[model samples]
Target: RVGLVEWEAERHLLMLDIHHIVTDGMSMSIFVEELLRLYNGETLEPLRIQYKEFAAWQQSEPVKERLKRQEAYWLDVLEGELPTLELPTDFVRPAARSFEGDVLPFSIDKQMTDSLQRIADENGATLYMVLLAAYSILLSKYSGQEDFIVGMPVSGRTHADLEPLIGMFVNTLAIRHYPSGEKAFLAYLNEVKETMLGAYDHQDYPFEELVKKLQAPRDQSRNPVFDVMFALETKEDNVQSFGDIKIESYPETHTVSQFDLTLVISLLDEGMNGQFEYATKLFTRNLIDNFAQDLLVIITQICEQPSVLLKDISLNGQSEQEQDVLEAIDIIF
Candidate 1:
């Protein structure tokens, strides 16, 4: 999926599509680092272990007990008939799901970013925790269910041995939160904080093993367990030069994803950027646009009144016609 957009035959946008199968988020950084080192003709030490060796060792007998405890924890946390959110879609959903999608890019102004950070600092939590709690609130508004699950990607590089290896060391963990209608948004952050800590502690459980341990009912039209995802992309301070031609980061052109909807918060030098990637077969651009705007509004609302109950928060107002369409599918917002 590589292409070139000609601009008067002087400049062009070079696009390259690297599938997640070949690598993941963290691997891309390592790939560029090694590529630069090789391009500079630097003498490097011999490799000690390859990705295949790491994979084989992961399934060895030494970590079975540790993995078993994680398996039990995940099984207990994710036990229930996972609710499939009835999101508003423009087109009819096909029996089989496709990866067709687009990314809606937005930015958080400096003021908003600063306010969010203040909220995080006051609550003794990271911005990621604040963002996840805000997203959970938005999801609860969209889907009328009080309890739901969201899947978040975790960097599964637990040991230093796998840091330099360009491989699939990323894993997805299901974070289930039961939003109490009476609790304040700040109180809810504590719940998200706890969930994040527990998930990281048990991250040694292989995702494939977790899937096998709890064989949930299969749904070809949607992904297993959870369909929504939230991730924060932190800026990496890597400057590599290949002779005189130094490599610079470019805006992402690939937007398609396997999930129903994914919200990626990119922390940039100027401000924070938000990208909403949703399945075109199951969601429309307008619907995703409303969601993106509503999420920002929710963040503002929470920052203003951290003590407000989760149920009392007001989402951005949508048109009556849009409201009707969403309600037709049981969506509240």
Candidate 2:
């Protein structure tokens, strides 16, 4: 759905409301580039493979065999009872889940960001891996669940031909982790890096298909495997112009939450900025604020002492009551 609102003569707002079913984050970039080129009266070369052909190919026997091989990998890693996170919520969970949610924004200073990047570089990992390890620690602190899955989206454009097209090529990977507070942050980060690389290798497998294969007990109150998600956006393109027409991206006012909690971090020129989008029925602003603070504290501490044990990490001066609340989940160590 696209719209154009003309505020005044020579002043108009172009709006594009795309659904995830037909397009994805990477596709949006391609869409915008093509849109601008076409606006400037330039013709793009014809795409070799259209979306219809791609869809058909995905359903072909060869693709099915490949997915079957990937399926075995997922099944082996995810075998046995899956861990359900017991994160403390302000309100009782409803019989069924609700999408009502809100976002709490936060930022990490440039110095802290640089320190984290240095730690990542030293550990043979990317910044995303470092952040994922820290996030897993945070989840462990709150839920006291050592084994859980975190869902992340990967661009499914494995072929170069798919790069120039606009389509929904985003696939979610359920990254399972067993975070031990007794383990050093650096060690856990290395393990996370390995897991991330393996997931990337099998990124083409569809998440829904994996869910069907698992056939875990169906729960109306939550998602099949994971209720939490993590995403990192490094692309910073926001402002553009087309022949004297200035275009600017507007900040979104999100009213829906796809999961119980989602941490979205954006890498910007200024620093590392992000937001925690949480379901309102399960959390209050104060709790999410504490989460943000605790996450930052963990990141800062790990950057300072990469070998520090996760159990000894700080929680941004949380109150004794708050500490008790988190500790009450389950004392593993």
Candidate 3:
């Protein structure tokens, strides 16, 4: 049994326990919702198929054909390009072996969230586009490269049958960003929206197939394509109670990826919470914290003043420190 207990100064301690098989981030959310609904006397129909069945069906021919198209598209897009983001390392980036990283989070107020949403709506774009634009600008500043790549997670559950079942139906797709001065923020966001839509239209392709088709070099030193991943999860109130046995769903341990960094944003009561996970061996905690804050500041500033140029977003006096770290890394590498 896996259990967690916490002590509070003002309130009594809370304890939680669950079987490993039934507990996961996604399952926890669903379980809490169902528990509440059941308590309210809401009867739900039985599920048509179990998760295992869905997994088996996912390996069928139609899915394979769709994946092939996705592989072809990615190969065409990434043909001969190397990673645009340059790391200050002399040693090659490691591959095959999985690495772990930690997360640093920054919070935004309700006003900021509302403002960003409004801007996105006004431009007929998505919140994802606004966030992606900010990320692109951040990458440009850090790497000193106007062209960079970010890997985004796509929900591969396109058909109705796959939605109810839980499995690893997630695919990573690379988005190439090129900041052209000729394009306005709104125009650039529109392009991103279109690209993402196209990606979704053909997301059934297996990522492994895409890698093979690209003939991506097998390097023990780095990831095949992109290192940074961005994900945004929509939030909901998830609380459960059975008489005196109350259980509140709160994130305990966050899973770290084998990439250099992963940026995740989830909605909170007041605003959005930004989380940044970085490889500890490659970066210091302070660096990760600063990077998160910088991205937040850039996004907030852009939302407040849409006319600002990409180059105008400053690190708020943190640039010197970042440069120092980069230089030290260069020397060590």
Q: Listing every candidate in turn, what is its Cα RMSD in Å to the true structure after a full C-alpha superposition?
A: 4.8, 3.3, 5.8
Estimate the TM-score for candidate 3: 0.78
TM-score of 1: 0.86
Please, what's the RMSD in Å of model 2? 3.3
| Cα lDDT over the full model 1 | 0.81
For 1-333, candidate 1 gives per-residue lDDT tens digits of 678677665454556678887688888777667766876888667777888998888788878777887888998888766666666677887888789888888888878888888988987889899989999888887776678888889888888978888788888888887776678888899889998899999987877777777788877787877888999988664454567645567655675777888999989776798989888887778889989899988888887888878877767654224556778879553
Candidate number with the higher lDDT (2 or 3): 2
| Model 2 agreement with the true structure over 1-333: per-residue lDDT tens digits | 889998999877779988889989888878877888898898999999899889999999999999889998898889999889889999999889899999999998889889989999987899999999999999988887789999998888899888888999899999999888788888899999999999898888899999999999989899889999999998456777778666777777888898999999999887789899999989999999999999998888887889987777767755335677778876855
Candidate 3 all-Cα RMSD:
5.8
> In each prediction, how many residue pairs overlap at the backbone (N, C-alpha, C within less than 3 A)?
0, 0, 5
Worst 10 residues of 3 by lDDT: 88-97
Which residue runs of candidate 3 sit more than 4 Å off their true CA positions? 1-28, 31-44, 87-98, 242-244, 250-257, 317-333
* C-alpha-based local distance difference test score of model 2: 0.88
What lDDT score is found at residue 277 in candidate 1? 87
- Which candidate number maximizes TM-score? 2
Q: Go through the candidates in order and give each one's C-alpha lDDT.
A: 0.81, 0.88, 0.71
